[model samples]
Structure formats: structure tokens, C-alpha cells
Target: MKYISYYHNPRVSNLLRIVSESPGLTFTEIMRRSGLANGVLSHYLGNMEKRAMIRSKKGRKMTWYFLPHDPIEEDSIIISLRKETSKNILTFLLTKKLATFVEVTRAAKKSPPVVSITLSQLQDLGLIKVTNGFVKKYEVANPDTIMRLSEKIDSTMFEKIKDRFEDTFSYF
Candidate 1:
């Protein structure tokens, strides 16, 4: 006899579908897309997490959610790049190829500390490389792969997040 899990409720299913479709969504973002109330979403998220149907990473401001062993594991870079500051820094580096720390801070319009931390995180993830010498410079490790992965994600959901993300970050 097989043991059936109780995580297949409609609400839980919807949450899983959303996370699977767009991995690395913050709790707030997931709530927005799932239309689940804060408490309700929290309950389902916790339950799913306990069941090992989901996993989350604590971001600078929010907890980002994802499915375990996501189908597009190669696209995990897109997941980490979901943060506004990280997105801005990487996008800037993708366009500029190589840039100094001050250039990244200026182009990305982020503060020195935020840029520094985000750059370090990207370096640790192997998504970007930083060189320190007379000047510190940063560059994306795999522009083509990042681009391809970015294109492969669901555009509709990504657009929704991107729109809200830009709106949320514009105030900062």
C-alpha cells in the first residue's frame, strides 16, 4: 500500500504550480500571484515545506521559494538573480561585460554596501567573478547561459514579477 500525501489540496496544488513555474519567488510575490491571504499562504507554505515539496532561501529582505530539484536546474542563475539589486548588477555587467565597483554601483543605482554584498554573493555562487587590483572589477561568468535561461522561464509570470519588482525597487 502506498502512503498518500495530504499536500494535494487545491490551494497547495496552486501554490506548488506557481513556485514550480517561477522558482525563487518571495513569499509576498507568491501571495500576490497565488492570491492566497497572508496567513493562509503561510500555513500552506509551511506544510508544503515540511512535506519536502518546497524549499526556501532567506533573501536580504524576503524568503524566496522554490521546488526541490527544479526541472530547470541549469537556470538556477535566474533564481538567484531574482533580487532587485542582484538583477540590476548582473544586467549591468551583462551589458558592460566588465565594470568597476563604482561603475556597477552607479549603473545599477545601488548603494556601495548593497553592491558590495550582492557582488560577493554572486561571486560565491559562481555566477559572476570579481577581480581586485588597482581597481575592483566584476563580470558575469556565463552571459549566454543566463540569457538563455532568462528567456526560457514563463514570460507571463516573469513579466508580472518584473513589473512589480521594478515598482517595488523604484522607491528604494
Candidate 2:
């Protein structure tokens, strides 16, 4: 599975950082620190938990939010690609590394017009290089950059997750 860039999402990123730095914070505490409404915070927390970025323990009256020992990595290529292309196109690209226009349309499950526009936007961002032909070839550009960014993102994510888990669950 490829790692995506959900970390760039402000709500998710902030919650992870805060929980990692200070575990076992109640919903109120997280809201106070994060400056997010209870509903928004809860939504982000739920998404993170689904992603295995964090876990929760319910006590008598209070709920403690903690990070999981292992957090899943997002797809670096897809994340970066989305910055250049539409998310749908990026998802298709992930499944089909080098695809023709027709292939992208099929994989993206979008109309040809939409796929073409997205491909053009990505090409403009230099995220993908395209060759014109009966069957155009589209290749991912700056793979090294993507890899480097992935490493950086994963390192930061793991560091935060580790810190949160230790702070909340460690028996030292």
C-alpha cells in the first residue's frame, strides 16, 4: 500500500502533534490546546483512530486519547501527486504508475474531459512528464524528491506517534 499525505491536513496533524507531546489529554484539554471545536476535534480523532494513528481508552467518566504504537504511513507519491493533479487522478496514477490518457480516464473512473484537465494540471506542476502520441506516455517526475519527502513525513509521524504512546502507556 502507498502512503498518502493526510498528515498535511491541519486538523489531523495538529491532533497528532499535541497527543504525541502530551498524551492522555481529555477532549476538553485537546480542544483548549488545539483551539478546535469539540465536534471538529472528535471528527479528526475518529479519522486518526481509523487510520491507526491514535487510540482511545474510556474510563468511568473521562476519555483518554493516546497514540498507537504503530501508525500507518501515507502514500508519498499520491500525496505529492495531488498537489499537482486532482486527487482522483493521483489515485489512478498510484494504481497505474505510467498510464496513457485512456488508461488514466479508466482508472480514475472519470470522464475524459476531467482526466485530461487533471493530467494537464499535473504536467504543469512538473509532477508528471507527458509524451504526445496516439497513446501518450505519462511518467512521474522527481521520484527522488517524492521519496525524500516521504521519508521526512514518515520520520516526523513516527516520532510523534512514539512520543504519544510512551507518554500515555509506558509503565516506567
Candidate 3:
């Protein structure tokens, strides 16, 4: 299943926060920590499960819920952040290295107001560097690292496809 975006969901955020505090927790415990009703927690859990952000093990009596992977990992953090904000901006920053507000607006094909808000939010998260001037340079922080990591992780499926295609057509 495709990963459902959970970046802005309060329950998912609370769930992640709770999981970060303590890795392995049952749904009941998570519910307790989140102070959300079972129905609400269940919906969040289902979404997280679809995203592979969290996993569950069905015991005879109860089910346990926890992050299948590390929450502090850079990719996980990026995914969570993108889920919470404009993924287009993330792509633009990662691809363009640095972009001013105007540049982002054009690249994202979004309105000036929307682009400005996204840029401001990313700046608040310390993900981008924005400057004020006639010709402002909004350099992406750690461009090399973020770009390299994104490429490494995102290329896996494409690499596999390329390999398969080569294997099938190389003789021709």
C-alpha cells in the first residue's frame, strides 16, 4: 500500500513523540499517552501502519505498536517533515541546491503567498537558509548531504528496474 501522509496528523505526531520516548509500546499504552479515544488512535495507527512507520504484533490478547524503523534516522525525519509540509518545496530545495522565494514559487508552480509560507515554515525548521535583499539567496543547509542521501535512498527502486531492463535487453 502507498504510504499515507501522516506528517500533520496530531495523533500521528503524538504517537511518534510517545514512541520516541519509549520504543516498544502497546496500543493501549499509546492511547493512554496520546489521551485519544480508541477510535481516534485506531485511525492513526492504521494510517501509520500503511505508511510502514509503525508495526503491530497481534498477541493472543493484545496488540503492540511501535516504529518498525528508527524515528531519529535522517530519512525518517525527512519523510515526516515532508508529510507535514510541502513536499514540492523539499524537492525544489534538494534539486536546486538553493532557491530564492521567487524561484521556488516558479518552480513549484504555486502562488507567491503559498511559496512564501512554505519557505518560511522550512526556515523555521532550520531546513533552509533565507536572506533578505534585492537578490536574496536561499541556500539549502547541508545541500550535499541531503542531496546525496535523497539520491541514495530514492534510487534503489530505479536502480533495480535498470538492472532488470539491462539483463533482459543487453543481448539485443
Q: Per-residue CA lDDT of candidate 2, range 29-136, in tens?
A: 789999998888888888888988888766567666767862323222333432323545554444345778877777667788877877786777676788778778
After superposing candidate 3, which stretches have Cα over 4 Å from the reference? Answer: 1-69, 73-77, 80-85, 148-172
* Candidates arranged by lDDT, highest first: 1, 2, 3
Task: Tell me the TM-score of each prediction against the true structure.
Answer: 0.72, 0.40, 0.45
**Whole-model Cα lDDT per candidate?**
0.77, 0.64, 0.63
Candidate 1, residues 36-119, lDDT tens digits: the string is 899999998998899889988775677878788865455357666676787778767776678998899997797899888888
Model 3: how large is the Cα RMSD against the reference?
13.5
lDDT of 3 by residue, 1-172 (tens): 3336557666677787786655446678788878999998898888788988787656566666556764334533244232324556665666556677777888778889877887776677666787768888676666554554444434453344346446656777
The C-alpha stretches of model 2 lying farther than 4 A from their native spots are 1-35, 38-85, 147-172
- Which RMSD values do the candidates have, in order? 7.2, 17.2, 13.5
Q: Any idea what lDDT model 1 has?
A: 0.77
**Cα shift from native, residue 69, model 3 (Å):** 4.9
> What's the candidate order when arranged by decreasing TM-score?
1, 3, 2
